[model samples]
Target: MTDDVTAAPRIVVGVDGSDPSKAALWWAVREAGLIGGVVEAVAVWEYPTAWYGWTPPQAEVFDYEKNARRTLVESIDRAIGPDRPVEIHTRVVQGHPAAVLLDAARGARLLVVGNRGHGGFAQALLGSVGQHCAQHASCPVVIVRGPGEASND
Candidate 1:
């Protein structure tokens, strides 16, 4: 009888240049290594002027997709080591973070995200993106809480 090994499940994690997102990236790498699966680091960045009340003369001025993609790739490369065999992919989309992350989860076995993001209230609210992803992602979601997350008494 021949023994067959099943490939590890694919994992998707969202990153937005925040401390919590960085923590999630680190956690995702470790988990991916343990499971022998690759990690997809996703960053969702839309044209900044669209929702900020600034009408740019040229749409390209606020287009952050390329920069965001590069940031994610570089960050993953640095964190996972240059020679490691871990497979990582980077994607940048123009849309809401939650929607983008949820869509990416369609083919993934697991979705990982930070408990907080760069846009939420500093005191007591979980980031809207994380909250939405946790509630609606197609796969199991893992929310990596940051150091600033408070513990319940």
Candidate 2:
């Protein structure tokens, strides 16, 4: 019989520099190891709406994309450590987090995201991005929950 697992599946995971998101990354790595799949770590960057009215001096300006890329790398290093066997591809996109994750998940075997993000609404059990992807992603979605969090349903 031909080995059906010959093809390596692609798993798209969202990272937002949050603890929960890092947990999701580690979970994705473990899952990829089991399925012999590759992980596409996608990090989205955009200036906060509050920054629309203010522009810093040229030297004081921030590089949002560069910061996002650094965050992604640090999260991966902290989560997966330096010795990992699975293939991981990192991507830094500019757009809404949910929209970016959904777009990246196209043609992917699975989509994984953290239950919450680094936002002010700490009371919110499910972050907007995770909720959106769970409801709208094309492939199977996995929302990794951090400690002390329980699913509503």
Candidate 3:
């Protein structure tokens, strides 16, 4: 295991408004506080587009970024409480969740994620986004599994 003293590790956590993810966020915040590092809360959202075979409305439509930002903040507030010593940063990206998280993990000292999310069956068998990060991230990855959620892999 890499010693925590090697660097004041920056923790990246992926939140998708799921109970397990909430637990992950809570864990990340506590771990970041313990390590005296910052937490980057990331949410990946993709707007419906031609690639997905969805037609765009003529008028200006929904603001996915704004909504994602709000969700990230709300999740952090719900998990870490309103006032905490941990520094939290929110980022919303447009792409696949696992890919985006892996890219974000490049500069992060550690990547943290839940064992499962809103994604159901595929994630369960594949070990979710946390497992993907653990396998591919440049930095260390931590998988925070929630209580009562059986390990499928």
Candidate 4:
């Protein structure tokens, strides 16, 4: 018999502790459960570019990644809840959100993200990261808008 378990689809979802991101994770998990797939939750972070041409202290950089991992873990727990329905994985990376998600989505069955993230211009229909992934991801992309999220368009 073929090892079907090894071929299970992997859905990569970008989560940033936002309500919309949580909604995306919820949707991805539900879809994965239905398709007998796996969910990969990705969280990306980077030092502010304001400190251009200068790197932060090693401890500071390490602390940022440490905190990012912690937040990603908490976000996954809160989004998936106690009763996990599908096998889920978490990834924490340091880079632009769109770039990080795009890289993580390589070989993934699907790429999922929130319609809008914790970025400027909340009134826009799709946040920069979501829009970029939708246009450039190798796999299909799903943009989940949180409840009550209205758009100017």
lDDT by candidate, in order shown: 0.80, 0.90, 0.82, 0.89
Q: For model 2, what is the error of residue 73's alpha carbon versus the real structure, in angstroms, after optimal superposition? A: 0.6
The full ranking of all candidates by lDDT, starting with the best, is: 2, 4, 3, 1
Q: Residues 1-153, candidate 3, lDDT per residue (tens digit)?
A: 566556577899999877777898899888998978888899999876675678677587788888887888888878878797788888899888999999988878788888878775744633557667878999888888765777657
**Scored by Cα lDDT, where does model 2 land?**
0.90
Q: Using alpha carbons, what is the TM-score of model 4?
A: 0.87
Model 1 Cα lDDT, one tens digit per residue, 1-153: 322246566889998877678788888878988988888889888765555678567844543777787777776765556775677778888888898999998978789988888786866457788888888888999999775676776
Worst 10 residues of 2 by lDDT: 48-57
Clashing pairs in 1: none
Q: lDDT (0-100) at residue 64 of candidate 1?
A: 72
lDDT of 4 by residue, 22-131 (tens): 99999999999999999999989887543665764564335668887887788888988889999998888999999999999998999999999888687777899998
Q: On residues 1-153, what C-alpha lDDT tens digit does candidate 2 reach at each position? A: 445456689999999889889999999999999998999999999875646666445657788999999999999999999998799999999998999999999989899998899975887888999999999999999989876676789
Q: Which of the predicted structures, 1 or 2, would earn the higher lDDT when compared with the native?
A: 2
Instruction: Output the number of the lDDT-best candidate.
Output: 2
Superposed model 1: Cα runs more than 4 Å off: 1-7, 50-63, 81-85, 148-150
lDDT, candidate 3, at 72: 83
lDDT, candidate 1, residue 44?
A: 86
TM per prediction: 0.80, 0.87, 0.79, 0.87
For candidate 3, the per-residue lDDT at 84 reads 74
